[model samples]
Target: MATLNSDYLIIGNSAAGVTAAETIRAKDPYGTITLISREPHHVYGRPLISYLIEGKTTLDAMKFKPETFYEDHKITALLGDEFEALTLDPEAHEVGLKNGDSIGYGRCLLATGSVPFTPPIKGLQGKSNVFTFITLDDAEQAWAAAVEASLKASESGRCSRVVVIGSGLIGLKAAEALSHHLDEISVLELADRILPTVLDPEGSALLQRLLEPHGITCYPGLTADEVLGEGDQAVGVRLTNGECLDCDLIIAAVGVRPNSSLALEAGAQSGRGLIVDERLLTSLPDVYAAGDVVQVCDVLDGSEHPLALWPNAMHQGKIAGRQMAGDETALFHGSFAVNAVDFFDISLLTAGVINPREDMGCEIDIYAEDNSYAKFVKQDGKLIGYILLNRPQNAGIYTALIENGVDLDSLDQDIFLETPQNLDFDNEMRWERLHKFYPRDLDRRGWKEKI
Candidate 1:
């Protein structure tokens, strides 16, 4: 096998891995850094793939970093290659590639991201018209196939139909994009509401209504038992409620499961994701994990959950890279889920635990109107969580307060009604927000028992 030597080998080329490489270059200017990915394209925002299908942006515009990013950082990129195994041992610490080659590393970071969770529905795979809206290639193929399907209906003057399974962020974004391309777009969610992971039922309902004008219909509380097809082509989707909807194309946006088995098989600690301590190290020596593949402290209830958002991945990657470069003080400040998405003009921002259990002793305040909705959640008089829609201007301040535990007792009720000004915050909080790192765990209250 051909052997490639490196001081740092990062598996995956998106946010976490790339950020890690950048951070490493700052510390060790002469060390060799190798970043690999299954995709051939340069790193781009995964979330923007849906917008590419919707015709809002071109593939070139999707590039998050310039082409010179790797060259400028003095990093070697192994794109369009799949990682097969970790050949770390006494003799050589390296990663095996799908091809007959291995890239040896002094320290390896596993930032391999998640893959789409394919639901257990019959006749879903091997269908030419079926696709997952996750990667850039997935978006390109889905859009090309959808255009071909549209040409078939040119004589009939009817719109091609697109069914997006799951009403989470991926599903809604796909539906929104396909609505502009096809005649009909329907979102089928197994849950009763959309964005169940982000927004509560009330916020979800508002989003559903806002999406109606975009020519997209959402069917909640529906599960797909089978994907009906005709001779290797997807024709319709069969739901558990005894209804079959015609579909020219289907985009599976159910959810994503962490790609942690590689580390687990290599004998690393893992649960829903690769488990890590404050140092972000795995069970094995000289091996660390970051990004969507690793579980992080939620800090809300002192639980570990996959904060798969891009920002968290970038932050974790920086910390992991610093730690790998010999910074023992690089401890994780903790993370929770935070998502902000705009669909056809209706902007939604959800941070932390939106709906805390009643037994958790959280105070809830809601403001809902025709086009705006905001829900604030607090524990011990400090902001803990919030969900805002249509009104996203001052959303950052609210999120800062949640992470830093700003006492809500001082703020007037008008904080929710308008964009909160800097004067609204105490001088200390304002200074930290503008100058220093916002302290996430400086508060006195301890972790309470989960109800």
Candidate 2:
């Protein structure tokens, strides 16, 4: 039980924690900074785990920064340490740790992130071969198990199959990875379509077509009733429709829930995630929260939602870091829940508000084709949301318009009605907004030179 003292103490060391450290160093280079992480490895991009499983990249390449990032910034690193509790003392400006140690901090950040939510299906417990793909360790174990299952089937002359329970990004990636080695692969989703919260029906159809060529079967609108196992190892799963599929590997990608238990125990306000203000500060003073562990306001919807995107986490972390370092230079402007996915030969990108309610007095416009579709939602003369499929080049432009609340009423509605290719930005209003956002590009194009 050792004690530590630092000007800033950060718990968790993935996207949010790492960004916070760099931001703090950027603002206050002389302050003592301590970062604690339960992971043994330094900061690495978690999204690359799927590529690693598919043998597309090596572990070394996935390092977020460099091995010496902490040392280079004169920051103390604590690896393989879990944050068990948080006890704040306002008068002393100190926090108590579960390791029987205390840290005296002028400011503290909670970036504890989230944990995979594995539903309690019958026979799921005590299964040796069932795994979840979340952490690096989780990916390592799943990859190893997949390899072993493949080898055993080859040596013992048995069929190898894998059932992935979820149709979200993680589940799809896992199914793709297992499809490379397994004899058969199936994805089970309780929702009516894949990527229910992200992609619409047409977008999901394109994805399904891409997966079919790779021998991945998707069973949407189906729920897992039980994990069928022989002895201690999972052998298959029983579907709610009374269908049993034989599988040697089972990867649970049901989704994730914010890990806010410590914050809750510390009397911090908790909703779907730790509630934080615009400054990323929690209800408690000198205590801040970010990353997937915090519920942030959706700038578009004006409702609290969990933005689990990596970029959102990093941005939130930077804001929290700056505010904690005594610089009120930034605010967590919130996230638009943007996400992109590339599988097989199809690529999809979506951002901002989605699925506008028909009764919300919003106008919806769509341009659809067999290969692509662009949908835009306008409310009160402002662009609210957009969905782009197959065509990704103009996504940035649409995202900017929606995020900046650019007025679209003056522009010709026919521009959005036509195919994205037929659209032109010659309109004064559109050009003005576009140039404002891309001033450097405009300068490079000599458009600003004449002005």
Candidate 3:
């Protein structure tokens, strides 16, 4: 019921919102900032959710910032409150919230993030044992349900089996988590291979070999037709091929869709996500958008696309915040679908543009083995993309080279085949450029220290 006036108002508390709040506070110290989130907890790293399942980190450790961050930055954080509706008044430069309150803001940012996409499969709604992995609440519920099923089975001498739909990062992580508690865990992917968007068939095959020893079953090219339930709880899943797999739990990890309905209903331009300009500004004046809710331009294709990565959200938020604070910084350079994931002992790192056109002119170099593979795609003498498995040491160097459009002709490809330590930056111009960008490295060890 309380009205508020702020210099800036940010919606959602994910990577984008958190970074936007901090960036704005850094630029405009005296400007009042209000951050609203539907989530109850403070901002946390979404990528670490998988590690959390592996017991690599606890909930507190996943927090991106401390609980007192907002207080210290003089930002008002509204947790556990949903921004149900958005009504814009151009004359007053104000927005009305569903909580019967209005906020007058000099600038507004919509970092609403995204929501998991649940396919329209029959018997899904009535099933209590079926779940989706997305929010913190979803992770907590999944963990609790998995543990409970395991414990109950242990007590009653019954079998506990879990089926995970979708073979992307979320499904893989969920399967890994369930494997820790349940004896039988299977991942069913609709595509021919896992991580179809990021990794090629060769890379997926290597990962499958690594995961097979961990008691995780991988079923590729299988589609879920319906959720099979007894009474009100899901007991198994019915596949499109008429195969029914009995299981105690089913976790759906198909994908996520941008939560941009509010923006659309408010008359903001939207497509797969809220459409925005290079500056992350929506069609509505004073209403900027970022994070997974907005479609961002891809650096390689120069086309608007949805990249739901956490780093992309954070970087986009920084750009939005800076522009909102009256800085004329350029729009965010689009992101490549880069990922670093590990299962068992093998690690995989993928970066830059992927899926080369068959007819398009591009050079492809591949080094494949039974245990690992490395591939690079180049166009116009510039490194465009790469995929590395089991050999992740020099990933940063490749990422830098690809991002900066560095001419790879001067560097020997064989040099990169070795460890990152073997690479030489003795050339004065290269060293100077690298040093200027990574000044901290230069300061730590005087420029002459590493040669």
Candidate 4:
């Protein structure tokens, strides 16, 4: 096997990988950087896959960065199945590929995101018209299948339908994307409500109401028992309650698990996910892991788990890159969950511990009027979580409060009663935030609080 060497080697090519490559180049312009990606395409916004199927965005428009990004950064990208990292030899500092080629690196980063977790259900094996929503290719194939199914159903004078298992963000988004082509879309979630992980019961109900008008129906507290099929193609699904719903397509959006096997086999420590320190260094020497592959510290609950959120991955990539480039000060200070998404015409923004455990002794306040709803969760007089639906104005203020653990008593205005603003903070905090690195010797009262 031929071997190539690089100063820095990064695996995966999504948000975290791309960001780390850019950061490394910015810090060390002369280092040889080699990025390996199993994906054939250039780096694009993974979140935009549904938009691509919805016709809201084109393939070219989905590119997260400019087309010449790799060339401009002078970084080598080994993409497609040929360059897939099959093995990691920590002692040898090399990664083996399927194509009988290996890459030796001085320092390596594993940003190998996550993979969809498909549960064991009868008739799922060797089935046609069944898919998972994750990669761009998945979206493309699903869109094509939807078009074919719709055409066949239209010719037969029947409504085209799709049954999606799991009503989390991925499943719901898949339903929304296929709604335009199919006559009906049903989301089956075993949980009691949609978006169970991101929203509270009330918020999930509100979003479900919004979704119904768009021909997307959610079935909570129900799951598919078996995928009923006809000649290798899925014709319908039998629910756990013994009801059968016919569908032209089946989308399994169950969940995702970190792709940490490569690092684990190479002797990296793990607990739920690959364990990395504050600097993103794994147990293996000269090896680091970031993004969804590593379990990171959650500032809210003081627990370590894989945060698959995109922004968190980007932040981890930056810290990992900086640390790899010999900058000791660059560190990851932990993260809290946050999600902002829009469905049809309505928008939802949530942050932190929206669903605190009953034993945690957190206080919650909720306000609802018509289509707008706001809920805040606090612990020890500090903001920790919030849900804003249709009342998204200045929602970042709440997020900042949660991230920084700002004390409610320190503010002069009531954050819950009105929309929060910068002026809500006292004069000293206002200056410290507005000009974060401004001279500390300057007058603290210069920026007067208007509110």
Candidate 5:
């Protein structure tokens, strides 16, 4: 077996892994850095897969960094290799790859991300045409298959329909992209509301109503009981509620499971995901984890939960990378479940404790206008959560207030109706936030809008 040695070994090459690598390079200029990737291409923003299918951008432009990034940092790249096992030795920390290569490292990071969760429905197994909507490869396969299916159906004078089994982020994005090429698109969700995990019934209703005008219908509170198919290809789906719909393509976006078997095999702790410290260090010494594969502290309830947002992943990767490079001062602020999505013409951003339970003594305030809406939840006199729709400019300010635990006793409810000002925050908090986020060149008058 071939063996290699490096100062740092990264198990995945996507968002968190790439961020860690760049941070490590910044801290240690000449250290040996080895990055392993299961995919064939360089690190790219995974969220762009939907855009790729929509023809908004090509695969070349999906990279998270420049093409010369790895070369510029003198990092050794190992692409298209799956990691099989992680073996931590007392004398030498080593990792085994499926390609029969072994790597010895001073420290290692696992940012393996997550895999799509395909719920088992009758007649769904072994269907060649049924695909998951997660990876870039998955997007490419689905896009090709959709086009071919539609064209073939056109020969028979029939319109092609696509059934996306979920109305969450992944499913909605897939449906949006497929709508560009296909005539009919339908999204199925097991919950009564679309985006149930991120948005409440009202917010979900608003999003669904906005999308319905664009030829996409969301069927909530129903799921596939059976995937009706001929041979190895799917033709339609039978819902659990005894409704059958015909479709040419089946794209499953039910959600994802963290790829953390390697972490468990390495004797690291695992919950819903691999448990990591504030430093992004795993249970095992000299091994770290970040991104979707690791669960971090949630700022809202003070419990460990998966904060699967892209910004959280990027920040986690930076913390892990800095720690691996011998910088212990780098600490994560906190992480919370958050999502920002655009459905048709409406843009929505939700974060922290989105749906506050009245049973939990949560005080909820709502403000709704035509094509614009805002909701805030306050608990223990502090901002706990918020949801904003068709209001992009106010998102950052609300997020900051929630993160900082600003007391809402003196807060103006009118702030929800318009852009909040620095005056909305107290004098001390205002000065602190201004000093922290104030731009260098932009004057105060021009910059307060951004706060």
Candidate 6:
């Protein structure tokens, strides 16, 4: 095996890993940086895979950065199966790859992200025409399958149909994209409401209404008990209620679990996800973890879990990169659940704790008119969470309030009664909030000053 060395080694080539590499390059221009990924392609937006399937974007146009990204940053990229990381020896500050190569590093960032959690349904294994929506490759394969199914349905004089198992963000997005090509798309969600983690019951109902008109039907409170198959090909699904539904394609979007096996094997501490401190450092020295692979404190609830959101991953990666470059002041401020997604014409922007336990004494406010719906959740008179559907005005102001933990009592008007704006707060408070948000927008020096 050949031995390679680098000043900084970043595993995973998606959002978090790429952001960390960029941050490190900006701070330490001369450092030898290396990035590795199991994916063969260049960096692209994982969330845009559905868009790619919808024909809204091409494969080339989905690139997150230019083709010359690695060369421009002077970073070495080892991608695809040839460089798949198999082992992490934190004691020796080295990683073993499947290609019989070993890499030594001064500092390492594990941004391995998450893996799809496929439930153990009968006849689901080794099945054709069943896919998961995560990687760019998965999107391509599923898109091709949809095209084939449509052609076959046309010959049989029947409408093309697909069954998506899971009504969360991934499953619905997959349904939306496939709906454009197929005649019908059915979403099977085990939860009573769709987007269970991101939206409340009312918000979910409002969104489901919009999806129904676009040839997408959501079956809540039910899931696939078995994937009925014929010769290793999934033909239908048997629901827990014993109802059978035919499908040309089966997309398993149940959810994803943190991809922390390598870190755990290397003796890193974990609680559901890899545990990292303020500097994003793992239990092992000189080994940091970020992105979906690491658990982070949720500012709203103060609970630690792997935040799989893209923005949080980027923020964590930037902080980890700074710390690895010797800037200890780069600290994580924790994050809450924030997401913005659209299905057809229906748009949703949500943040923080949309659902609170009854024991938390949270004050809830909701407004629904026509197709628009807004819900606010507050605890101790502080805005903690909100869901905005089809009404996207002043969403940043709401997010700012939740992130900064601004007291509602400080404002002169009820933010729920009217649309929130910067003028809602006093001039001094407005300036303070704006300054904090843009401190690092100029240069890296500004980051230290703010922190």
- Strongest candidate by TM-score: 4
**lDDT per residue as tens, model 5, 217-318:** 899999899999999989999998898999998999999988888778768888888988888888888889889888877878777766667888899999
Encode model 3's per-residue lDDT on 124-194: one tens digit a residue. Answer: 78677888888778788888888899888888898788989888888888887778888888888899998
Instruction: Flag the better candidate by lDDT, 1 or 2.
Output: 1
- Tens-digit lDDT string for candidate 1 (1-451): 3388888888888899989999999998999899887788889988898888777787789888897999999898888845454444423576677776788788889888888999889999899889998888888898887788788867677778988999989888888877777888889989899889899999989899999888888998996889998999989998889999998999999999888766776778788888887788887788888999988888887787777889989999999999988888888878877899989888999898887888899888898889889998888888888899988987888888888777777766578767877778676766655656534554423344345
Rate residue 327 of model 4 by lDDT.
Answer: 92
Clashing pairs in 5: none
Clashes of each: 0, 0, 0, 0, 0, 0
List the candidate 5 regions with Cα displacement exceeding 4 Å. 82-92, 409-413, 426-429, 436-451
For residues 164-277, what per-residue lDDT tens digits would candidate 2 score against the true structure? 999998898888777777878899999988878877777677677768888898999997899888899998899999999988889999999998776786778888899888
TM-score of each: 0.93, 0.90, 0.92, 0.96, 0.93, 0.95
lDDT of each: 0.84, 0.81, 0.81, 0.91, 0.84, 0.91
| Residue 282 CA displacement from its true place in model 1, Å | 0.9
lDDT of 5: 0.84
- TM match of model 6 to true structure: 0.95
Record all residue pairs in model 3 with backbone atoms less than 3 Å apart, i.e. clashing: none
lDDT of 6 by residue, 41-147 (tens): 89999999999989899989999999999999999999998898999998899999999899999999999999999998888889889999999999999999999
Task: Give each prediction's root-mean-square deviation over alpha carbons.
Answer: 6.8, 3.3, 3.4, 2.9, 4.0, 4.5
